[model samples]
Target: MSMEHHPHDVFFRSFFSHPDTMQALLQLLRYKQMVWQKDDGPLTPILPILFYHGPDGRISERFSQLFHPETPEHLRPQQVEFQAILYNLSSVHKDRLTAEKNLEFQAALLSLKYARDNMDLMIDELYRLARTGGTVFLSSKRFALVKLYLLHASSLTYDEIEQKIHTRITDPVIREDIMPSTAQMLKQEGRQEGRQEGRLETVHETVVRMLAEDIALDVIARVTGMTIEQIEAIRQQNDQTDQNQS
Candidate 1:
């Protein structure tokens, strides 16, 4: 696909293009390098951090724990005994995550924690956070990025996402700022392709395109004026065609 049509490429380009974002990223890299330097010079004090948000709990904390069970106990002292500070979002309470002082961090953590299982609740929590003084730390652009992240990570349709944002977030300025991103998302979903063709796209073609974009079946049915069963039939046919081609 073209770079212009790729959602990830577009998001990264727009995100990193900002001077503040670029500088913050560079500073983070510099700090990491400084803390974990492995040059000929004396070693820097290293404090590793593992930010984990998977469904499973963390299995190990120290490097030594990875050693073979058959290894001699006497050799234990010779092994590197490195330990990392683990920030396991899966194990953290929602209230604790919400209480985080950094607005960006709180939003990010909540998003990661719930993106797989409960994206709707995550959106509601984000809206609540914004309502309660979180907007001070988030620019419209940053909040838009957060919304884009939701779109990327969640299974919700674009219309559903728009509805959630519209219903939950009442700030007119913030809503206005997010309009451009909404357009970008629509373009990424191939919404503009139909317009550019100078003719209305057929139901079959529209369904195929929406399926490729991973839009929810109900949403596609609503847009295309078809039932969920009809959409599912199209999806199955498309899948069968792909298998035969392969």
Candidate 2:
């Protein structure tokens, strides 16, 4: 969980609260039991970790700490509680980001720390990691992943980052590996957007037909799975269009 801000504890709790998710995960764990067993008896523990880098000043690491203090302590027993380690990256200094002897881990954290304002630093560190094969911060083959990220996150152009990579990396095999990334990204994005637009258009047309039939907003909302407010807004928009045509 690479977060931009500290998340509410319920955010994590809600995930584990789902019985299907827990069951699936536990079943998977049982299938891959670390210890040899005649038959899988009990499921193992699940430790969910959150890597946060949000704008919040304070958020509790423990599950119980997220609750309001004004609530009665006795009532707290009924509430769901679970431990999740939150690594608030914004609060962590680069110098102190040891990352447990993994150079890749360290490099990733360092880049994340300076990603917003200092993209140059992030790119430079990534280049260093690629050169040494010392970090998985940005693998030599996957340069395009971060390139896409920077295009959205920073002012730097694709040409500029590609040139930077070309300057550092001369191997043809690696270059070939990175080339298709942007095209693949575009293809996936185009398909996803096309699907979404089609879906929205279908919904709008359905809403328009239902409005023409003089359906109540509440009934439309229930049948179409849209809020009453949304149905009303669509209704109003349709009315305005009719007035204009007239």
Global CA lDDT computed for model 1: 0.55
Candidate 1 lowest-lDDT run of ten? 10-19
Every candidate's lDDT: 0.55, 0.48
For all predictions, the C-alpha RMSD in Å is 15.2, 16.4
Across 94-201, the per-residue lDDT of candidate 1 in tens digits comes to 999988886766776787678657866886787676666544644544454455456655677767777877876678766554555566645544445445443234
- The lDDT, on a scale of 0 to 1, for candidate 2 is 0.48
TM-score for each candidate, following the candidate numbering: 0.50, 0.44
- Model 2 spans > 4 angstroms off: 1-46, 95-107, 134-246
Give the CA lDDT, 0 to 100, for residue 195 in model 2: 55
- Highest-lDDT candidate: 1
The regions of model 1 sitting more than 4 angstroms off are: 1-41, 65-80, 133-142, 167-246
